[model samples]
Target: MTRIHCLVAAVLMSLSLNLQAEGADLYPLSSPAEQERFQALTEELRCPKCQNQNIADSDAPIAKDMREEVHRMLQQGASNEQVVDALVARFGEFVRYKPQLEPRTVLLWATPVIVVIVGLLVITLVVVRSRRNTETSSALTPEQRRRAEQILKDAEAP
Candidate 1:
């Protein structure tokens, strides 16, 4: 039983070591500060190829390039803002996870609001026109009223 316990402990230790080794090769950032900055910046940036995912979370070639660029910028003593600005300059605002609020982006942001307002106005106009038509056509001609009364009397007789 003691031998079996030792074997189990050795297997657990090996598994832990293997898992650590797998991650060790992945984070190429030289220092903890650099790694943190790289992660923050990448997570904030969009991956162009995988538009739904941030750079750090994507496995695309562009994401890898972006990660490498982050490392390079960190080595050059560039601040997070500076790195992000550089990326925005090179890749445009579309590369950012959060698009900047600007005149260029006003249409993208305002289109839905404008459409909703127009839809409401259209519905209001339709309802108003229908209501007005109903009111205006409420009164029947004398001949039409007489015909309606005759039809109702026939229906009741049956």
Candidate 2:
């Protein structure tokens, strides 16, 4: 009974492994160059459904469809730019992992710099105000100077 159970488990494991191998086959490319390009594009493109994940890393249905579309376009002899343009037209700049520098995206690219500049301005204002306060408090009017000198003299006499 033990030998029979071991034989059955071995057969089941072999069958599962074969199925996985079949499923893992990549779409055929015309050449090694095309395969490299396909990989680069997939890694660079973001999945519309999985906003934070690139298509190569995402398992979302939209990502799967996008992968299929890219494979189809590459097989049909589409240039890298052409394939990217098609996707950007159908979906939007949001589908790109690195968006281009454009008027519409200026704010997105500049926000960090703008924030740093604003923070520096605030710190300068605070420092200047503090110094002004310190100087004003340290300076004495004529009457205040006389009063302080008199108090010091009285203390010395006692």
Candidate 3:
């Protein structure tokens, strides 16, 4: 009886798991035009809750809602740029995964490249300074070198 109960429980758990794994019914791609527009818009929109995922790929409730909104706007004969503009006007530039190139976002886009260049310049300066120091030390006058050696020898004796 215990073994039969365990078997039944396992079967029920598997069935429930399968049911929960069913794919969601996203808006049907009714036409190629609709699909193209959906694809283009989704790629641009960010998932507000997910830092790295776009709305189209995100399964978050907000992402689904945003996708539905985009579809509705497209169906209403809105141009892609118009739809994007509306979203930007409502949610701000952060709604887009890649923000538009503008003076406001210049720092965000340029920071990595600027940092790389500055870092390279710093590294070059450090290497050159090190080489210069080594060369200067090697060229120390004989009297100075002898005095430096004697000072080291006196310190070591203690």
Best by lDDT: 2
lDDT of 1 at 24: 47
The C-alpha lDDT values of all candidates are 0.86, 0.89, 0.84
**lDDT tens digits, residues 2-100, model 2?**
999999999999999998765445667888898888888888899998868898889898888888899999999999999998999998998887788
What is the per-residue lDDT of model 3 for residues 27-78, given as tens digits with 9 covering 90 to 100? Answer: 6566887878887898789878888788878889988888888888887778
lDDT tens digits, residues 1-158, model 1?
Answer: 69999999999999999987875456566788777887788889988889589987788998888878877888888999899999889878878877777999999889899999999999999999999999989989999999999999999995
lDDT of 1 at 86: 91
Q: What is the lDDT of residue 94 in candidate 3?
A: 77
Q: Could you give me the TM-score of model 3 versus the true structure?
A: 0.69
Query: Candidate 2, which segments miss by more than 4 Å at Cα?
Result: 1-24, 146-158
**All candidates in order of lDDT, best leading:** 2, 1, 3
How close to the true structure is residue 80 of candidate 1, measured as C-alpha lDDT?
91
Kindly give the stretch of ten consecutive residues in candidate 2 with the minimal lDDT sum: 19-28
lDDT of model 3, residue 53: 87
